[model samples]
Target chain A: MTEERDPHLARLFAEAPEPQADEAFVDAVRMGMARGRRMDLAGALAMSAAVGLTCVALAGPVAQAVGQVAGQVAPVMAELFDVPGGEILAVAFAGLMAVSAMVLSRVRV
Target chain B: MRPADSLRLSNAPEAQVIALAAAGSDEAFAELVRRRQGSLRALMRRLCGDAALADDLAQQAFLQAWRTLRQLRSPGAFGGWLRQVAVHVWLRHARLVRPPLDPIEDLDAEPAAESPDPAARLDLSAALAQLKPTQRLCIILNYVEGLSHAEVAASTGWPLGAVKSHIARGTARLRRLLSVEVLS
Candidate 1:
């Protein structure tokens, strides 16, 4: 069936002009792809903030429990870790987890 | 020239490039674009009827191919697979943006060159413009691009019967156009 068609048409169309693309267009696509790869810092920061706030919210009861524990060993903790204080330590741990979660969220895979 | 030697489907450099691109290798993806850009652009232009639109579609197609390369089972089928991506990308883009009506009938019909020399093949591009998008693609994939019917079916995602029908119809239209040009 195909043989019945003009063999020359295939040849002619086959001879089509080489498809040329503008260099800048190619560059733009490359740039778009590059931008797609980079992390959106603002988005990441916002997510981090949300995670941190959530952690802090969830840490309320945990913090009360820690406070109860600390009341019993306040003097001991003071001697062992006399820095930012236990409440601060607890908050810091929660903050760290939130930050980790936020960073993890930014990853594509 | 001769459709750039009818590139074989291979897991070679082409497939590796697609794989690497899928793995987020920008350079590898760029290499794939650079290698296939000519043919892809040509096909897009033939199918879409505009060089600028073709370029845009080609870029999108390459990006899409890069994003989904991992889904492809055989790396050896990258070229055909990529063409399929291009076709979908073109169609999608066309859908999103209305196609400007082309008075295809108004275009002057030109005769196919008698010469088989490399320069003669240059006329193929003009002849392609006379065809409908589907017919042009069929001819390009089958003759200029040298993909088998099975490959064409696979690449276009059309049933084997549909592929055969399109090829037959497309070839007839092209032949008629060629004859018209010759007589004119």
Candidate 2:
């Protein structure tokens, strides 16, 4: 603030003793940064594992939904693209792989 | 950083050093810390009025700055950005360890403790330690660090009115403690 300053206080602050840079302080910060990084990594891994477990727990329902959707869409696909029944399984597998890739991409691990 | 690496980036411009540090060069970050430690530590010392705690908090601030360095959009803004980081760290630490600060109305409940020693009389740290945490942070950020009231407001997440109030009252209290004659 323009009005916040006082000359006397400024002078005292100017006169305040400043600490010298210590290599030890630098080392301490370096160690702390490394530790912080490890903690971040561990947190990310934990979150990934939690997400993985959730996906595993939901896998049966998810697979069943996908299969049901594929079954309904397969007739339209065969009529539209002249695809056969067995090839519809390939399309379903490909769709499942694409969805799994998407889910895994968001896991951050 | 190697002892030889100390002088390597010492002479580089701050913006360039900041850019390199943002690029994840630890050496550059080291240089940035070395160049900045003096003022940052001094700011912490004035804010907390304790050398050891100030350094500890300053180091924590630097570690935080390092972790978030890549998010800095403007390397030229590092000084202000770093100060904001330091203030946040201080706020977090204060909130965790210290009792909630006395409300502004109650800030003057206790007169600054009397000290018989003349040295303590002359010591600004002793006087600063008498301020409530909010007042102390605002006073230091405004006076010592030369931040504007609005800047201090943004830094501490306090309203502009509150920052102005704290600085005014804190400065008045400091003048009274130091026996510095008020202009009024």
The number of the candidate with the highest DockQ is 2
Q: What is the total number of backbone clashes in candidate 1?
A: 6
Candidate 2: tens digits of C-alpha lDDT, residues B9-98: 888889989988888888888888888888899988888877899999999999989989988999888999999999999888888888
Where does candidate 1 stray beyond 4 Å?
A: A1-6, A20-25, A39-109, B1-22, B97-132, B180-184
The CA lDDT at A106 in model 2 is: 50
User: What is the Å distance of residue B125 in model 1 from its true position?
Assistant: 5.7
iRMSD (1 decimal) for each model: 3.1, 2.9
lDDT at B41, model 2:
91
Best by lDDT: 2
Cα-based TM-score, every candidate: 0.59, 0.74
Q: After superposition, which runs of candidate 2 have C-alpha atoms over 4 Å from their true positions?
A: A1-4, A47-109, B1-7, B102-122, B180-184
Model 1, A22-78: lDDT tens per residue?
Answer: 566567668767665554566788899999998777666555554554465546545
Scoring model 1 with DockQ, what do you get? Answer: 0.28
lDDT of 1 by residue, B24-48 (tens): 6666666677778888888787776
